[model samples]
Target: MNRRNFLLSTAALALSGCTTASLLKKSTEDTIDYQREKVSGFFASVDGKKLVVLGADYHYVMDQIGDLPQVLQSPLKPRLNAEFSYFDLDHDNHVSGQVTLQLKGKVSDAERQKLQMEGFECKGFQEEVWTKVYKVRGTRYLAKGFELPASVSKFNHDYEIIVRESHSPGVKRAMVLLTPVTLAMDGVLVLGGIVLAPVALIVLSNTHWR
Candidate 1:
């Protein structure tokens, strides 16, 4: 091919490759969305507390859900029709002070009671001093708490308190479980790219020559 033709062919191939890459990216995103929608159907939460519906792996839920589904998203449509009731003593419009977090999950009454009691033991605190307690009624679990040193001035500060079962080991255990799954995902993606590369090259070569 002449110099102009060669450059034009290269440009055409580059454009086609870009288009294919974009389509592949779109497909990956669609797959992620499908997984999220499916997972959301089973997830439930209440009063800023989340009950993640875990698979056998358990860790995949966090990977698929991405960023621990926030408290507000629980009640929305297409997701679980769960209810959340927030009992805020400091009605000062700030996230501070004596907020009760209740969660209803699929578990036996005995297990639920244990979780409720353990989950109320103030995991972490921010800005203000706080204490938590759990109340159980049949199958539901309630995490009642008091956040003290409530904002005394106009200077507003935001804080969070995470309460979880001590025995559970919390986020550290979660990360350990997820590490293998994350690595596997990376490996699979790499293998897929290796398998597709030659096919992509051939298609680009044919299109570019045309």
Candidate 2:
């Protein structure tokens, strides 16, 4: 190819790469915001006959889903450690357990190992299996969770630092089935940005530059 035309093509590719990079960055930020909104900062669930959680600010998935961030923090104002549970007078077989988790959004290698050992099952047998649509009262968010089986360990799923939890009255330990909505939305944006560059390149190549 001629020198001028070759240089033009190269410049176009560089600009396209920059566009893709920007899109990815924005998608990451939006995804973080979306994650926070979905769980409303925190939540709680009852297990067995005790209050295992109340306002638990736990994240089972990470923003990138590749490597856990070095430092992650809950959105709770002045976040602190908590251990409280109350009765759910509004709903039967339901209770509110308020737990303050101490997380800086960082998980170490040791922590990851501990979690793997804990696994995602309980008692090697979880019963009363069923599915339900759990909607966060004030928002339009919905999640599907399952009742944790009779746990052999104190905590059904011993995550990074989640240890022996309580099981409140009539409340059975159930796992919440969640979807990465924000990530999905941002993904579309990234994809669109990618398509644009190729189309731009094609159009440019066809234009009369004489």
Candidate 3:
């Protein structure tokens, strides 16, 4: 390929290679791992932080009704829900590893305990109001909230940062497990395979092999 065409091909191939990794990330965050379903909208750039969403989905029961599907439904299905995720703490995961904090704000003691039982650690210091705020926005199944990548100190600007959620009998935690470095490395591999391989061939073609 000519120089311009070759360069364009390289970028396209690199991005397309990222698609598979992105899909894998999506499946890991989904309750059902459906190829088309993704909860990534809940995630903002977070200044390109090194973080990851852990596990496939959330498993919990909010109350008696929440337990009914998993316990008494005709065709049995586990009571699983997708978590709403966001990056937390100024301290980087790359430097500090995973650390736990008391989840701030109005989340009830029982609800917090339930999440702790499920292995979710408290992430950030911000008020935990997304669930209540989301209920005010609009109703949807399997909801998620994404805070803006940047921080703002103003009260009126709250909407610009955290996403709101709807009301429901059940409570859920935003969980994560991977580092942003992992995804970055995946991109590097794709760049090496799809982009650099062809460039190396081009260079080799121009110079005689000794």
Give the residue spans of candidate 1 off by over 4 A: 34-210
Clashes of each: 1, 23, 12
TM-score of model number 1: 0.22
Over all chains combined, what TM-score does candidate 2 have?
A: 0.23
lDDT agreement of model 1 with the native: 0.26
lDDT of 2 by residue, 144-209 (tens): 342212221122232222222334446554553332222123222111122100000001111121
* lDDT of candidate 3 over 38-94, digit per residue (tens): 222121112221122211121111111122121112121122222222212111111
| Superior by TM-score: candidate 1 or candidate 3 | 1
* TM-scores, one per candidate: 0.22, 0.23, 0.17
lDDT of 1 by residue, 19-75 (tens): 999998776554321111111112323222322221221211111222123422423
Q: Which regions of candidate 3 deviate over 4 angstroms?
A: 32-210
